[model samples]
Target: MALMTTRPWKHPKTGIYYLRRAVPADLLARVGKREEKISLGTKDPVRAKGLHASALLELEQRWANLRCGAASLSEREAHELAAPLSAWWFDQHRDEPSQQTFWRTDLGDGLWPRRPPGWSLRPAVGAALIEEAADSSVHARCAMEDWCSEQADALLKRRGLVVDETDRRKLARAVAAVMQRASLALHAAMRGEAVDVGQTLVVRPAMPTSAMATPPAEMAQNSLLPISLTALVEAWWREAERTGKAASTHEAYAHAFRLLVAFLGHDNAHRVTKHDIVRFKDHRLASRKRNGDLVSATTVKNSDLAALKAVFGWALDNGRIIENPALGVTVAKAAKVKLREREFTAEEARTLLRAASDLTPGRELPQTYAAKHWIPWVLAFTGARVGEIAQLRRQDLRRETVAGYPEGVWVLRITPEAGTVKTKQAREVPLHPQLVELGFPAFVEGGRGERLFIVPDVKGQIAGPLQGVKNRLSEFARHHVIDPGVSPNHSWRHRFRTVATEAGVSGNVIDALCGWSAKSVGERYGSVSLKARTDAIMRLPRIEV
Candidate 1:
C-alpha cells in the first residue's frame, strides 16, 4: 500500500507544490472558477506545508471579507483608532533626526512666511534653537499633511483596513499629526537635543544577548538574519534556486541592496524604514544618468521597489521580520508619449529579414552563427521573445504527431531545460512551413553541439552567454533597422502579433505560440494542443523578403 500523508499536491513537471481546493458551489460563479490551484512555489515538502496553510488561511479571509461587505467607521473613530500607527511611525523615525526638515508655519492670522518661488530653508543651529522651536513654534512639522492625504488609501490597504471618504480624511489628518510629532522629535535630535512628543515617542530597549532564545553562534550562521543585508539577499536567492528565474535576476536584486547600503552608509536592513526608502527614492530621482537625463520612474519602480518588495516579503514570510517596510511604497510612472508605431513596418521587417537571410556563414563567431542566420526567422515566424529563441537547444526541435496531420508537425519545444523561460512553462511551437522550406530541419540535424545558439556554463546555466549572443544579435539587427522607437529585436514580437491577427489566427493560439500568459481564468482551463498550433502556424503569411 502507498504511504498516506497530508501534503500539498506536487506539480509533475515543475515539482513545485500547490494548494488545490475546490470552490464552494455558491462561490463558483462569483469567483468564475470551480477550483483554485495556487502555487506554493517551493519543492521542499516541509516548506510547502507551511506555505500551504498560510495561503489557505489568506484565501479564506479574502472570501470571508468579500461576503461580509464593506464596513464603515465614524470619522472620530477613524482618527482615534490611528493611534497605534502613530506610535509605529514614531518608533521608525525617532532615531533618524538628520533625515527630517523643519518648516515654520504661523497659526496666528493664518499668514505663513512669504518666500520667493522655489526657495528652500536651511538652518545651522544647536540644541537650544531646536528646543526653542519645539517650545515656541506653533507646530513642528514637515509636508506630511499633504503626504498623508496622498498615502492614506495605500496605508489602509497595507494594514487590511478599509474606510469611507469621510473617515479617510480624518485618518489622514490623524496620521499627519503623528508624522508632525515624529518630525519635531527628529528635528530636536538633529541638534543634539531630545524632545518629548508624548508617550508614543518612546523607543523600546534592546534585548540582552544572554536573554535571547537563539544562541549567538546559531544566529551568526543563520542565512535569514534580518539585520544583515547579505544574509537576507542570499536567503532569497536560495529560495529562488528552483523557481526558473534567471541568474541575472538574482544579480539585479543583489545590486539593488548594495546600492541601498551605500546610500544609507550601513548594512543593517532591520534598521531601514519607509522614510529612509522615500529619502533614497528622492535622491535617486534627483540624480541623472551618464546621458544627463533624470532616471525614469519605471526603472526605479521595477528595479529598486521590486527588489525591496521581493526580499522583504521573503524575510517576512520566513519569520525573519514582523513586517515588510517596503510595503505601501511606490513610484507612479509618468504617462508615455507616443512617437512612432511600436511594431516594425513591412519595409523595415523586409529589410531585417533580407539582411539576416543574406548573412554569410563562417564569418562571425561560431556561437553566434545560429543567432545571425536562423534566430531572426524563428522569431519572425513564432513571435517568441529573442531570449527564448537565443537559448534554444539543437535537441529542442523534433517531429511530433498531431491528430489532423498524418505525417505530424515539426515542433520546437521552448523549455526551461534550454534556459529560463518567462512563463516557466514548456511550449511547443510548430515550425512554420516557411522555416522548413528554408532548411531549418537540416540546420538542426547538421549541428553537433548541444545548444543551437549560445554556450552554457559548467552548471548548464546559459544566462550569462545567452545575454552575450542576444546582444550580438541585437547589434546585427540595429545595423539594418534605424528606428528610434522600435527595439532592434523586440519589434519582431509586435510585428508578428499584427501579422498573425491579420492572418485570422485565434488569440489563444497566438498566446500559446508566443508564450504570452492567458488573460482570463476561462482561457486557462484547457491546453492549446499541437494540432491547433500547427493550423495557426500555417495561417501566418510568409514575409516575402
Candidate 2:
C-alpha cells in the first residue's frame, strides 16, 4: 500500500509555519497508491500548531477519497511533483551544508519545479509588504537619474532656476550624476524631448538628403531644375542676398540657380571646374528639344553658353567660385546673312489673307481669328513686332489730322508702357484704309476698356492672347504650306521690313514707325512726334485680306 505524510515547520523570527511534504520511495516507485506530501518548513510553535491542523484536514479528505477508491496515483502527477518534493527534502536537511550551497545543489539537480507555498509572503506582494519595503532614498535616486544634462540646463534657464555660474555648475553636475546613474544609451535617450520626441529634435544629414539634391555639374549646367529642389537652392538664395545683387537680378538669379541645383545635386557643385563646363556645353549640343528633334549644336552652344556666362558671373560675384569658367567658349555664328531671307510674296500674302478670312472645314473659328487674321496683315503692311501688336490697346489708337492731309488718318500710338519696343522707344503706326475695309472696325468695336483683341479659344477652353495667336497662325501656316520654312508670324514682320526698306523709306523714319531707335544716333533721335511717324507709316501699301 502507498501512503502520504505532511511535516510542519515554523520560522523563529516570524512565527510562520510552512508545510513540508514527504512520500515513501517504494510507494512513489509503484504504479498504484503513490504518495505525496506538502511541507511547512518553519519551526515556530504557534505556526507549527496551525500547520498540524491544516494537515489533518487535508489528510481527512485524502483518506475519504482513497477509501471510496475514487482517488488513484497518476504517473504524470508523480513525475511533476518529484522536483517539489526533492526541494522540500533538501530544505529540511539544509543545516548539513551552507544554505547557498544546498540551494545551488538542488537547482543543479533540476529540483524546485513547483512554487513554494510561502511565496505569497514576498515584499512585492501584499499592500502591507509594499508599505514596509518602500525606500524614499531609492525613489529620489531614480528621480535624479532621469534628468538629461542639456535638457536640465535649458529647463533651469527657462524657469529662472539658475541665478549664476554657481547655480549652473550645480545643475550641470546634478545632470551628469543622474545620467551616469541611469546607465542610458546616450544616442537613444537624446532622441526624445523632456517628455517625448518632436520633429525639431529629429537628426538628419546636413547635406542634400533627397533624390533631387543638386545634380552633376554637367547635367545641371544643361537643364532647368524642377520647383521642388529645396535645401541647396535655398542656401544659394540666402547667399545671393548677402552679395547685394539688384533685387530683380537676384530674383532672376535665384530662379536660374534653383533650376541648376535641381538638375544637379549640391554635391556636384564643388566638382564643377572649368573643364566640366566644356563637357556640359558638348552635352547640350547633343541633347534634343522637347519636340524630340535634335537641336543644332550651334544653337545649343550659343544659348547655353550665354546663360552659363550669366550663372558663372553671379557665382564669381557671390564667391561660389573664384573665376568664370565660361570665358573663351564661343558659339557658331548665325548663318542668316548668307541664307536668303524668306518673305511672303505678294501672291502668297493674298492667298494667306484669303485663307485667314474663311474658317477651315470641320474646325471651329478660332476665338482671335478675327484679330489674328487682320493682325498679321497689319504687321506685313506696317512692320511691327508681334509683341508690339499684341500690346496695342483700343485707347492707344487715335484719329489724326495733319494740315496737308486731305482726310484724318487712323493711327496707333505704340506706348513704351505696353512693353519693350525694338528701339526701346514709343512711336505711332498708321492704319491703312485697306485694313479698315478688312474688318479692323468690327475688331476694335467688339472690345471693352484698354483690351483690343478677343481672347482665343484653346484646348480645354482656356484662352490667352499670344498663345492663341501663335496656335492659330501655326494652323494656317500648316494648311497653306506657304514657304514651309516661314513661320506665319515671323514671315509677316519680315515682309513689312523688306517692303519698307525696298520702297526707299528712310532707315530712321522706318525705325521711328517701328519703335526702333538708332543706337548710334542715341535717344535724341529715338523720340518723334506721334503724328509725323504715323504719316510715314501710312505711305506703305496694304494687302487686302
Candidate 3:
C-alpha cells in the first residue's frame, strides 16, 4: 500500500486548512478536472481534520458512484437511504410545541391563524400581519418539503446513487413518509406518551450483504455468498483481542484491509481470491510514496500482505472460508547492507543529550517537557526501546535496596502494564550512576501525573497521542542528528550495547537489562537479579554532554 498524504493542507497566507487531491487518470475525464481542491474554512487543525475526513468520504463516494454509473434502486434501498431523514426531523422538532400545527393538519391548510383585514391599515398591525403571514402553515410546509428534498438530493449525491425521475419521486415520497413518522413521534412526545427520540441516526453507506449478521460457522456453510468486509474484520478483531494482539496493530491492519476493499471496489471478503491478492500486490508495488519514491517492498509485505494473511488465516480457522486468499504471498528478500554502524557515535549521542537538556519549560505540555528532556537520558542509560521509556509511569520508577548498595537503586520498570512491551514480559533496569548525578530522581519526583512522560488522557490510545509524541520526538532528534542512515530514537539501543561491552558488562546481563530475548535455554533458566543488574549498570559509563 502507498503512503497517503490525505491530511488537510494548510494555506501559507491565511493559515486556513484546505483539501487538495489529484483526480485519478480515469476519473479526470468524467470529473472534468486534473485535481479537486476545497477550502476547509477552519484555521483550527482539529476542526479541519474532522471536516477533511467528511469531505474526503463524500468525494470517494461520489467518485465510486461515477465509476459504477446509476443503478436501479429497490424500494428497500430507497427506504434504507431515507431512514435518517425521520430521525433528523424528530430531533429538530421534538421539543417545539409550536411546530405541532404543521404536522397536525398536513402543514396547516385549515389551522393557520388569519390576520384581520382592517388591522392591516394600521402600521403596527401591518407589520404584525406580515409576520403572521410569513409564519403561516403553507410557508412552513413548503420550507419543510424543500429542506427534505435538498437533504435527499445531497444524500443521493454523497452515496453516488442515481435514480430516474420516477425513482427519484419514489425516494421523495419515502422521505415524506419518514418525515410524517417523525412528526407522529413528536406528537407522542407532546402528549406525554413514550417515544424513542434519542435514536442515533448515523448514516453508513456500505455494500449490502445478507451474511453480515451471520456467525462465522454459518457464513462458512454458505461460503459462496458475499460477506461484508466490516463483519469479517470485527470478528477477526474479537478473536485477535482475546489472543492479546495489540490494539494499535489491529488498527493498522484494519486500515490496510479497508484500503484493499477500496481498491477492489467492493467489501465482499468471501469473493476475494488469490488472483485478487496477486494483482493487489502488483498494484501496491507500482504505487509511490508522497515524495514520488516507489512504495517500499518491505511495507507491502509487512503491512498489506501480513494483514491479509493474518485475517484470512483467522477466517479459515474459524470456518468462515475453506482457503486463505493470502496464502504463499511474499516479498522477495533484499540483501542487507551496512552503510554505517546502526549505533550512534559518541559525538552524535552527546549532541542529542545536550539539546534535550537545554529544553526549557512552558513551551509544550508537562509530559512533552519530560519526554524532550529526560527520555533521551533514560534511553541512553537503560538501553530500553524509546516507546518503553516514553510511556513510563510515576509508579514504574521506584527505589529499592539491593546488594552492593544499601542506599538503594532507582529502577525503571519496562512493563506491558504501562503500554505495549515487545516481549510481553516485564523487566527492570537500574538507573545509571550518571543519571542519579543529573537529578533524574528529582525529575521523576516532580511529576504529578500517572505517566512519567505521556499525558493521562492520551495514554489509553496507543496509536493516537502516543504516536504523536513519537513522531515529534523523531523530528526533534533528526533536526540535531542529521543522519538519514540511522533512526533518530532507535540508535540509542545500538549505542548502549557498544558502550556496555566497552565497560565490561556481561552479554547476558546486558541482554536482560535491555529486555532482549534470552539467547539459549540455559540463559533463560536463571533470572538476572536486581543486584547483578545493578552491578552491571554501575559498570557502564554515561555519555558526557
Candidate 4:
C-alpha cells in the first residue's frame, strides 16, 4: 500500500494532471467546497509540478480575498473596467475636432506646423450651436484656471454626462492634445501656408511670437483665486474620515496641515503655485520648524511635505484643482539618526513583571493597576504591541474549544473594536501558563468594565482614554525601568521576541502569534493550531525576579 498524497491527480480518461488539495475544513463553509482542483494542462511530472504550484497560489489568494470580503467584479464593475478603455478609444478617433477648429479660425485649434497625421480626418460638426461654443471668446478672456473649469463644464455638456476625476483628466488631456495641433495652424497661417477648405476661414493664434508682446492690460489681470489653503485641508480631512482612514493618519495629516497653514499664511490654494510650495520646502530643509527650532530634513518630509502631497493629490484627483502644486516637489531622503531597538534585559524583564504584580493601589498606581500591571506582563510574554494589549476588552479573553485540539485553548483576541492593531489583522495569542499562574485569568474574570484597561475620557471624545493610557504607560516606564537603551512598555514586546527566538521557536509561529502574515507560500496552506502555538509558547523560560 502506498501513502496517500495530494499532489497532481491525473484524470484516467484524459491523462491530464490536475492539482488537487483538500481545502481546510474551517474555510469550507466560506469557500463552499471540500477541496479545490485546478487542471495542470500537462501529463509530464515535472511540468505538472510547476503548474500545480502556480495554480495553488492563485486558489489561496482567492480564498484570502473571500475571507477579506473582496468579491469578484459585479456587472457594473466589469463594465467600469472596460469603460475607460472604450472611452480612450472614442477620444482617439473623435472626428469633430478639425470641424470645430474650422469654426474657431483661431491658432489654438487651427491647423498646425507639427500636427500629427490624420489632422484633416475629423468630421466637421455642422451644428452651428457647437461651433458657436467652440469659438466662444468668454474663456480666452478669463484666467487659465477659470478657462479650464469652463472647458470642463463645456465638455460635460457636450458629452451629456458627468464624470469622475479620472475621466476629467482624460478629457483634459484629450482637449490639450487637440489644442496642440490646432495651435500649429496659427504658425502655418502666419507663414502664408494657410489652406482653403469649404467654410474654413484661417484664424490666427492669440499667443504672440517673440516679435509680438502681450498687452500690459492682459498681464495686469489678477490670477489669484479665492479658494483658500484652509479649505483644501478641511476637504482632505473630511475625505479621509469618509474613506475610513485610521484615526492616527487623520491626526498626522492634521498636525502637518496646521504647520503649513501657520507658515504659508493659510491663503488661497489656487494662489499658491509651485514657486510658493518650493519656498515652504526650502524653509523646512533649512531647519525652519513650526516651533521655530531646528529639526531634521526627515521630519520635514514625514510631516510637512508628505501632508501637502496627500492634500494636493486629493485636490487634483477630486477635480478641486486642475493640477497638483506639490506633484514633483519632495524633500530628498537624508540620513536618519540611528536608534537602538528598545528591549529589556532578561533580568530586567523579570523585575518589571514582578513589580507589575504589585497589588497595592496608590496615588501613583491607582485602581487601573489591574490592567496597567498586566499590560507589560502580557506584552513581555506575547510580544504583542502596547496598543494591542491596552485596548483589549473583557470579551476578548477567550478559552474556547478549537477543531483538531483535544483540549480547549486560552487565547487573547486582539482586535480593532476596542482599539487599532498596527497590522489590521486580528490574531489570537495563546495565553502563557505563567500569566495564568499569576492570577491573570482570575483578574480578567473579576472585571465588569467594558474595557480591559480603565483610562480617563471626556464625553463624546475618542482619543482621550487611548492617549491617556499611552502617556501614563510612558511615565511608568521612565520612573520604574531606568534603562537608557530600552523604552518602558514597548521594550517588553522586544524582550519577548528576543527570548522567544532564543528559545528556538520557529519564526513563522512567532509571527502567527503576533498577528503577522505568512512570509512563504507553503506557510499559507496549513493552519497554525492553538495547540502548536501553546506548545511553542510553553517552551520559554518563566520570568523570575
Candidate 5:
C-alpha cells in the first residue's frame, strides 16, 4: 500500500498522488475552492513527486498573482495580455493599398460595418466592443500597437536586421496578420461567429524575425520573443516610484537596472538567463571605476543585483518571465567601509583654499563659477558633507538662540526639508567665523533662487540634484584635494575632527558638530550646548589665503 506523506497526498484507489494546500478563506472565493489540489497523473511515486513539486510551485505563484496582480513582461503573458487587443487596434487602423483593402474590397460591410442597430445591440458586435473596451482602454489598446512596433524596431536594430522593400512589407503584413486575427476574434465573439473560447481569441504568431537575434525556428516559441528591456525598466521604475518607495531607493534601483540593460546587449530581458546573471556578477566584481580599483562584489549585490532582483521578482510573479534569472545568485557580503584616516594637513588645506579662491570670480551669483568656487571652502570650515553644503537653502544658515543660553549663534541646519541626507536625523552646525568673514551672507543674498548652490536638477523624476554636487565634489577632490588616501569632500570632516581633537574638543562635541548620531547613552547625555560647540569650533586656527 502506498502511504501519503504530510507533504504529498496519495490516492489509494489508483495508487497515484496529488498535491494539496489549504486556501485562506479570503482567497477561497478568488481561487474558486476551499483547498487547491492537482493530480500528479502518474502511478510512479517518484514521477508523481516531481510533478507534485512543480505543480505546487506553480500553484503558489498563481495564488500570489491573485494577491499582487501580474507584474512581469514575459513573452507568453505579454502575448496573452497584449497581442489580442493591440492587434485589433492596429488592424482597425493600419494603412492599406487603395485598390484591394480587406474591409473595403473583400468583406462586404468592412470591419465594424454599419451593422443593423438591433443586431449590434445584442451580445455580439456592440457587446463585444464594449467588453473589450471595458477590459482595456482606447489609449492602452492603441499604446500596445506602438509598443509592439517599437519592440520590433529595437530587436531589429540590435540584430542588425536588413530588409528590402518586399521583406519589409512581409514583416508588416505578418504583424498585421496577428492584429487582423485579434480584431477578428472580437468581431467573431460579438457576432456569434465564435464556436468556443478558443475561437473568441487568436494566438499571435512570433514577431517579425528578420531583425530578431534568433532565427525563425529558434524564435518559434512565443516566450522567446523579446520584450524591450529598457521599456520594461522604465515602466517598472515609474510604477515603483508611484507606489511609494523612497525617491532615493527608487533612483538606486533604476541606476542598477539601467546598467544591466546596457550590459546585456540591450536585448529583451526575457533573453537573459541565469548564465547571463553570473556573467554580470563576475563582470561587476572584475570591473574598475575611473580611479581603476576593482569594484566590490558587495556593492554589486546590494545596489545592482538587489535592484535587479526586486524587478525580476516582480516580473516573475507577474508572468513576464517564467523564471527569475537573478534568483539564487549570491555575492559575498562586504566588510564595513573604512574611510582612510588621512585628512588635510595644514599646508594642503591652505593650498586648496587658495586654489578655490582663484576659481571664484568677482560675480557671486549662485549659478556662476564663483558660487561653485565657494562650495569647497564652505565644506572645509563647516565639516558638513559636500551634498549637505551644496543642497542648502539660504534659510538653512540662520541665527538662533538656544533655550538655556542668552547669546544667539549663527548655525547651519542640515535637514531633509531642504534636501536629502544620509542620516535622516537633522542637526545644526555652527557657521565658521571664516565663512561670515568672507561675506558668505552677502553672496547668498545676491542669489535669485531658494537653493544656495547652482547645481541644476540633473536628477529626473527619481533622483536628487545633490548627487551631481557629490560627484563634482569628488572630481574637484581628484584635482584640488589631491591626496589618494583622502576622498576630497569627505576629508573635510576628518580634518575638522583633527582640529577639534587638538583644541581639546570632546568626542560628544565633535559628534554634535558633525551630525554624527549618539553611539552610546553616555554620549547622548554628553552633548554640550550649541554655544559651547560653536565656541569649541571657533578656537580652530584660520589662515590668510
Candidate 6:
C-alpha cells in the first residue's frame, strides 16, 4: 500500500493554520475552502507539525510585546495621549521616555518618527497629566501643598484674620481644606466630561494692604508725660542725698513722700493742688498706730507738717513744681511736759527675775530659747543689751580675786569697730554668773572669729547678729503675754540699776559696772577703779531661783 503524506493547511472558516494528516472528509468539510493548497515546504507530516508549533510561539511573543507597550503608558501619559496633543508642549521637554517619544515627534527631523496630528495632548489634558504627576511624586505633592498653604496665609492676611504666625497656620489649614474640596470637584467635572485628568485647580492668592499692617498708631502722645508722684519725690530725695543731708532729716523726708504717694497716685503728681496736701495732714491726725486712740492733732501738725514742708521745698527747688503746697499749712502746737524717771519696784523686779528663771522651751518657741534657754535669765542678771551679749568674745572674759571673793566676769568692750553704741561712748559691762553657767564660753570661744552669739539654726538659714536674739526675746514676750511696755529688754537694764542701788552699792561703782555715766559734780566722780566696779557688781544680792 502507498503511504499518505500530511501537510500544513490554513482553515478558511476559523482563519487558523493547522497540520493535516490522515485526512478525514468531515474534518476537511469543516474547513470549507477545499481547493486551498496546504504548504509546509514539505509533504512530510512530522516536519509540518514542527513548523505549526514554531508559528504558535512567534504569535505568543508578539502578543506579549503589545501588552508591555500598553502597560508602559502611565495614567499621566495615557491622559496626555487621549487629550488634544498640543497641551503636552511642556511635557515634550521633560526627561522621560514618554516625553522623549513626544519630543522626537515634535523636534526631530525625518530620522525620528512623527506623531500623528490626532495623537497630541490638549492644554486641559496636559494640566490634568501634570496634576496626576504632582500627586504621584513626593516632591510634586510637597510643592502643591506648600502653594496651597501660602495661598491660605495670603487670604488670611487680606481678611485681617492673621493675628500672628499661629493664626496664619490655622488659616493655611482651612484654605487647604477648601482647596482640596475644589480640586476634587474640578477633578470630578473633568472626569465626567472626558477632559484632561491631570489638570489641577489653582486659585489666586490675595494680598493685605491697610493701616492694620503697621500696627495702630499712637492715639495720643501722653506716654512721654510724667505721671508719677513717687518720681517727683524721688527726684527731690536724690538731690537731698547728693547734698549730704543728715540721715534723720532724709528719713523724715522719705516718710512725708510716702504719705503723699499714698494720697496721690504716682501719675497725679503734676496735678496735685495745695488742697490735697492739707487733706493728707487732716487724715494723719485721725489715724492711730496700734490702738483706737488717734494720733494727736498737734503731732500731725508739728512733725508730719514739718516733713511735708521739707518735701514741697525740695520739689520747688528741683523745678518739680512751681509752688510749695505746704507753705501756709499750720500745725497745732504741742504742750511740753516734765517727767521724772521711775525705776522698777522691788516686787516687780523679783517677779521678772523669777519669770526669767522659770522660762522653758516650748513648741513654736524661738530656736534661740530652745538652744540657749538661760539667755533671758542671764540678761535679767547682767542687764546687758542683746548687742553687748552678741559682741562678747572669749578674750573679753577677765578672772580676778577681790577681798577674798573669786569672780568670773566677761567685760563688754565697745570699740567703734564693734558698732554704734546707744550713747556713742565706749564702756564695759560685767557678765553675770548665770551666763557662765549657760555655756557662754562655748559661744564666745567658737565665735572668736566674729561676734559671740551664733545664729540659731532656723528655716531658710537666716543667720545674722544680735538682731536674732532681740527678735527671739520679743517672740518670747508675746508668747508668754508679758506686758510688753513694762517688761521689754530695756526694762531689764532698769531692774539691774534699781536692784544694785537697793543692795547699798554706791552709784559711781554701779555706773562703772553697768556702763552708765555717774550723775555727780565732776567726771572724776564718775570714774571708778576696775576693781571697785567688779566688787560693786558682785555685791549686788543674788536671788536664787
Instruction: At residue 37, give the lDDT of candidate 2.
Output: 27
Q: So what's the TM-score on candidate 5?
A: 0.57
Q: Which candidate has the highest lDDT of all?
A: 3
RMSD in Å for model 6: 42.1
What tens-digit string does per-residue lDDT give for candidate 4 at 1-545? 21233577777755766656676666677644455544554567887776666656655665665555533333343233223222221232233223222213343342222445864465663464376467646344233334334444443422224456555544544443433444344334445564342113223221111001111111122222334566667767876877667666666677666666676885556545667778888876776433354776777777778888888766544435534566668877757444666688766776766777764677653435665687878887788887787777788888978555467667898887666777777777888878888878787888776676754355734455665677677666656777656767777767777888999998888888887778889888887777778877888888776
What's the C-alpha lDDT at position 16 in model 1? Answer: 62
Choose 1 or 3, whichever is better by TM-score: 3
| lDDT for each residue of candidate 2 in 1-545, tens digit (9 for 90 to 100) | 53333445443433444333343353233212233322333345666566566555654444443344322223342222122222222222223222221112112222112457987776657784576359554343332322223333333322223234444444444433322322222222334323122222222221111111122221222222211223334444565546643333444444444444444564334334456566666666676855355767655554556556666543433323323556656656666543446677777777777766675434544445555566666676677776567656677777778555668777777775554354546667778777777767567766664555444235522124444555565566656754556656777767877778776676777766766556684655435665666556666776654
**lDDT per residue as tens, model 6, 258-371:** 777776764444455668777888888778854255877776776777777876655543334434567667765667552433334555555555565576756643445532
| TM-scores of the candidates in the order shown | 0.56, 0.47, 0.57, 0.51, 0.57, 0.41
What is the lDDT, from 0 to 100, of the residue 281 in candidate 4? 81
**lDDT of each candidate versus the true structure:** 0.69, 0.48, 0.73, 0.59, 0.60, 0.47
Please provide, for model 5 over 77-164, each residue's C-alpha lDDT reduced to its tens digit, 9 standing for 90 to 100.
Answer: 3344334333333233332212112221122112222456687467567677777677534444344344345444333322224434
lDDT of 6 at 371: 27
Question: Candidate 2, 485: how far from true, in Å?
Answer: 5.0
> Of models 5 and 6, which has the larger lDDT?
5
> What is the overall TM-score of model 4 with all chains considered together?
0.51
Which 10-residue span in candidate 6 carries the lowest summed lDDT?
A: 207-216
Candidate 3 contains a number of clashing pairs equal to 0
Ranking by lDDT: 3, 1, 5, 4, 2, 6
Weakest 10 consecutive residues, lDDT, candidate 4?
206-215
Clashing pairs in 3: none
Please report how far candidate 1 places residue 387 from its true position, in Å. 1.9
C-alpha lDDT of residue 36 in model 6: 19
